[model samples]
Target: MSRRLVILRHARAEHGFAGPDHDRSLTESGRAQALEAGRRLALAGLVPDHVICSTATRTRQTLDGVLAELPARPSVEFEESAYAADLDTAFALINAADPDVGTLLLVGHNPTMADLASAFIDDPGLVSFPPASLAVVDLEVEWLYAAPGTGDGRILDGEGQVGKGEG
Candidate 1:
């Protein structure tokens, strides 16, 4: 089977509306949105093999929200490198991923997430990543070779705030 990369932009943050960039936390609404996204992912049977998150407070909290909605714990890694990573840095992270991880869940901020998605999502009609959104990109290679701009992926399915069986 082909490996997959599931890119998730963290849910809305307090900084998005009320604080400085680096120290922001997830608002109550942001947590709920993140849980909603998680529930949707669970319902769709799209849980990843592992979950990697940025150490940024917003993404850390977002990972918690996602984990709260799942049946069991997914292995997690909090990477300092993921924070403020540009496209090339992000690409290196993705391309050096473990090959056995059939699916990798990356919870991070925008620009990086959007930039990575844009580089590979083959659908001309698929663009835009609202907060708490999930993008399941189907790939045809090992996880370690799935570079940002060189991936062969298509947007398989997309959803938000979906209840069980609703998507």
Candidate 2:
């Protein structure tokens, strides 16, 4: 069966925060961007059946915004490893997903998110995943066997518009 993977970058966050990077929260514009992303997902008919998200505060808050616009909530898992995972780690997370889930959404930080999305396409140099960007890749293989360069998948759609504010 064909599977769909949605790669989402966390929304714009406040800078100069006196906390760890993981503790940084989304800004007002970031929240609007997240909501727009959710609406876009629904409009594109790419609503996920399951989501694997980073445990970072911004990522969680981003997911919250996306979830708010979704008609139905999908199963979600918050994983700390996804915070700053490398491409391999990200792939492993995707590969470990339940085959029963046809669509999976992964929300995290970059350049891992950008790297992972680029790796799926034949030309890795052409893709860029900015803040609050969402990319939809179609994978022919099951999640268990998903790997870099093995996706045989192309980006169906991508949106990098996270509003005209600080990111």
Candidate 3:
């Protein structure tokens, strides 16, 4: 059976929050972007059956916004390791997903999110994941076999932004 992975970058966050980076919350526009991203995913019928999300405030908020527009209430896992995860760590998290899930959504910070999304495709240069941006990848293998270059992915919604005009 075919599987799908949706890699999402947390929405825009305030540069200057009183707390740590992990505690930073989404900006107003970021909330709008997150909502739009969810709508677009729903529109594209990319609703996930399982979600692996970062435990950070911003990522959780982004997840909340995205989940709001989706019809399915996916089983979610709040992982602290996903907060500032690397590509390997991201893969580990992904590989640990429920094998029965046909679609999986991962929400986290960038560099990792961007790198993970790009790693699934042949041409990494073609992807640019801005805040609230998402990449939908179709995989040929099970979640246990997921790895870089294992799937073909495309940027959905916008190149580096979501809900540009509406937000």
- Largest TM-score belongs to which candidate? 3
**lDDT, candidate 2, at 39:** 84
User: What local distance difference test score does each model get?
Assistant: 0.74, 0.82, 0.85
Provide the lowest-lDDT 10-residue window in model 3.
158-167
| Model 3, runs deviating above 4 Å | 124-127, 158-167
lDDT per residue for candidate 3 within 40-151, as digits (tens), equals 8888888999999999999999999999999989999999999979899999998998889999999998899888877765562554678997888888789999998788
Residue-level lDDT for 105 in candidate 1: 88
* Separate clash counts for every candidate: 0, 0, 0
lDDT of 2 by residue, 31-113 (tens): 99889888878877778999999999999999999999888899999999999899889999999999899999999998998
TM-score of every prediction relative to native: 0.84, 0.88, 0.91
lDDT of 1 by residue, 1-167 (tens): 67778778899887554555767888899999888877877876778888878898889888888888877677788888899888887767777777778778888888788777777765556556678767666676776667654555433244433221111
Residue 122 of model 2 has an lDDT of 61
**Which stretches in model 2 have alpha-carbon errors above 4 Å?**
124-127, 152-167
Off by over 4 Å in 1: 16-20, 148-167
Clashing pairs in 1: none
TM-score: the better of candidates 2 and 3:
3
Give the clash total for candidate 3.
0
